[model samples]
Target: MREFPQISYAFAYGSGVFPQTDGSASRPAMSPHPNPPEAILKWQKGGGKMIDFIFATKFTQHFHSLNLNRHRDHYSFLGSFGSSIISHVQDDWGAGAYFNPYITVNGTLIKYGVVNFKTLLRDLSDWDTLYLAGRLHKPVKILTEDPNIRVANQRNLLAAVRCSLLLLPPTFTERQLYTTIASLSYQGDPRMSLGSENPNKVTNIITHQIRNFRMLYHDLIMSLPNVDYGEARALQQGWMEDLKLDRPMAQDMDPAFRGNMVRRLPKSFRQKLYFLYQRKFGISGREFEGMLEASADEDAKGGLKKPVGGPFDRRVAAETDLREMVLKCVNQTVKWPSATQSLKSALTAGPSRTLRYLKEKREKGRENALCDGTIVALLGDEGNESMDSSENTTEDG
Candidate 1:
C-alpha cells in the first residue's frame, strides 16, 4: 500500500487486522475440501476476510487521475465519466469519501476508501462529520502516518473520552466506558438500526480487544483532570476494570466544568451546540459568542484566566436539556453522512459487488441474532436450575 500513489495517510482496520472471536460462533463451519496443504494453509490464514484500508491523499482528483491509468478496473462504470467527475462525486458527497470494495490485490481481498487529506483533517479536528473521526476512536494499525494527523487524532481521542464521560454514570465498569465510546459512531448509523449490521458488533469488538482499547486510551484517560480508576490495581493485563469520576464531574451539573467540556468539543459541533442552545434558550448570537469566549479563556492549569462569567454558560452546562442537545448535534453530524456513504458505496462498488456485500452483511446479522438468542436461553435455564436447587435444600432442612 505504500506504493499506492500519493497516500499521505493510510491505515488498516476491522477484523482482518484485529482478530475477533465472538463472530466465530456466527460464522458457518468450513466444509471438508480436497486441496493441497499449501493452498489449504493459505485459505485458513486469509480466505473470506477482506482487509479494509482508508487512504488520504493531498489531491483526490490527481490521485484518482493517476490511478485511472494504473488500475482502471478499481473503478466502476462511473470511471468512464473521467477522473474529474469521479473526484467531484467523491468530494461533494457522502462524508467526502469514495470507497472501492471487493478488489483483489496480491491474492488477498481488500477494500479501500479514498478521501482528500484536508477533509480528513477537518473531520478529525472539528467533527464536521463523525464519519472518519468515529473510526479513529477505536484501535487501528497505522500504515502511513502524518505528523499533523497524529496531533488532530489526539484531539479526536480526547474528545471521545470527554463525550463518553458525560454520557456515563459516576461509577462504571471499563466495559461500560469503552462501549459508550464505541457507540459514538453508530449513534445514527442506518445500518445498525436497519439490521443490516450485527447487533453485538461493538460488544464483540471490545470483548476481544480490551488490550487494544487500553493501548489507545489508557494514557489519555490518566491525563484527564476529572477521571480516575476506582482502586489502585497492579499494572498488568486487563487493569482497566473500574473507573471513578470526581463527584462534580459525575453529576456533571457543574456549569463551569461542563461548559469547558462543551467548548472543547470539535469546532463544528460546538457551533451546532451554539445554535441549538440559542434556539432553546432564546439567546442572541452575541451572547452565545461571549459565553464561548469565556469558556475558551482557560489557562494550562484549567483555571479561568479572566473570569468573564455569565448565566448563559451556567445554563448551557446545568440545563436538563444538555444531553438532548448533545445527541441532536451528533445525529445532525452523523445521520446524513452515514446514509450517503452507504449509497456511495453501492455506486462505487457496482451492482453485483454491492449485492454480494449486502448479502454477506445480512447473513452475519442473522447469525448474530440466533447466537444471541441461544445465549439468553441458556442463561435462563441456568437460573431456573439454581432456583430449583435452592428450593430442594430448604425443604430438606
Candidate 2:
C-alpha cells in the first residue's frame, strides 16, 4: 500500500504510527494502579507497541500475489509456495485475517494482517472475532479507506454504543459506557485469565484515547430513545456521570431490541448466531426467541445493587443469562487466532519453531506491558515498541 493505492483499506495503529511525542495522553492516569483520579484510561492497543497495521482489498488473490512477490521473505516459508495458498488458509482456516509477522521495515519489527474487503465488512459489522472490530474501537490513524467502508464503520460504532448500553445498568455514567465499549473484546477472552494481558489494559486504553472515544460515540449517545441522555448535551463535550437511563430502560432491552441489534450486525454473524440457536435450542425457521433470550439479561426491576465500579459490575446488572451468552460467543471468537497462529507458525518455521514463536510473543507482551502505563506516549523507535493483548499482538496464544 505504501508503494501503490491498489488496496481498498489500510491504516497505521499503535505507537509506531506516530513519531515520539509527549506522553501526556497517558500521564494523567498515573496516580495509582487500580483506581486513578479522573482516569480516562487507554482502553485498547498499548502505546509504544509494535506499529500494527491492516489492509483489505476487494481482489484478495490479486493483491496478495503482487504483495507476496514484492516481499517474498516476509511470509516465511509459505511465501515460497504462492499467495493463493496463503489466502486460502487465511480464509478457510483462520478468521479471515492473515499476518506477515516480524517483518523488518527500517529495522522496525512490524506485523501487518491482510483480509479481503468482504471479510472486513462482515467482521466490522458483526462482533464475530471482535478482532479488527476491537482494534477499530480504539483510535487509529487511517492511511486509506473507502467511503463506503467509512459508512460501514460508523454503523459499527453505533452498534458498539447500543451493545454497550445493553450490557450496562439502567443508569450509568459516560465513562461507564466508554469502559463497556472498551471491554467488548476482552469480555470472555481466555487470555484475560492467563495474566498474558495487563490487568489495567482496558483502563489505560480508554484513559489515553478518551477524546477519540468521545468523538466516535457521542452522536449515538445523543440519539438513544426514551432515556434521559440530555446531560450529554451539557457544557462538557464528552459523556458524564450525570447522564442516566430511566426506569423504562429495562423495557427497551426487549425482544425487539435484540432483533434490531441482530439486523444491524453482519450477515455472517447473524447466520452463525442463528445456527447456534437452532442447534442448541431447536430454534429453526424464523423463530428468534433464543436470540432474544440471549440478549435480555434479567431486568434491574428488582432493585438496584450498590455501586461497585465503573459501568456497574456484571453481577449488579443482573444479566447472568445474557452475560453467559456473551462469554460463549466472545470466547468462541477468541479461540480462532490461536489455531491460525499455530498453523501459520508450523507452516513457516516447522512445528518446532512454532513454540518458540509463541513463547517470544508472550515474553514480548509481558515485557512491553512492564513499561509505564501512565501515558500512551510514542516510543523513540520501533526497537522499543511492543504489541499487547489489546491489539495486534497478545490477542491469543
Number of the top candidate by TM-score? 1
Model 2 residue runs over 4 Å out of place are 15-48, 226-234, 237-320, 337-361, 364-397
lDDT of 2 by residue, 1-397 (tens): 3443277776566544432223433422222224322211341222323456788889877887888767776666777778788778777665677776666553334557787888878778666677677777666666565666676677677767756665665566656677878777676554566654656667666655555555566566556552344342443533333333211222254444444554444444444544554565554554555444333323347542332122112222233354455446556665675446446646654444456656755654464233332223222222123221122211111
lDDT digits (tens) for residues 1-397 of candidate 1: 4235777887666765555553334443331333424433333343346667789999989999999888899988889988999999899989999988877654446688999999999999889889999988887766667779888888898899877776766677666788889889988999988878888888777876676686677777767666776655524454544223211223344667666676667778877877897888887878777766655646668785653325665567777777777888888989999999899888888898899989987876764432211100111243224323321011111
Candidate that scores best on lDDT:
1
* Model 1 worst lDDT window (10 residues): 370-379
RMSD of 2: 11.9
Question: Which residue runs does candidate 1 get wrong by more than 4 Å?
Answer: 22-47, 234-253, 289-311, 369-397
The collision pairs in model 1 are none
For each candidate in the order shown, give its overall lDDT on alpha carbons: 0.71, 0.54
RMSD for each of the candidates: 12.3, 11.9
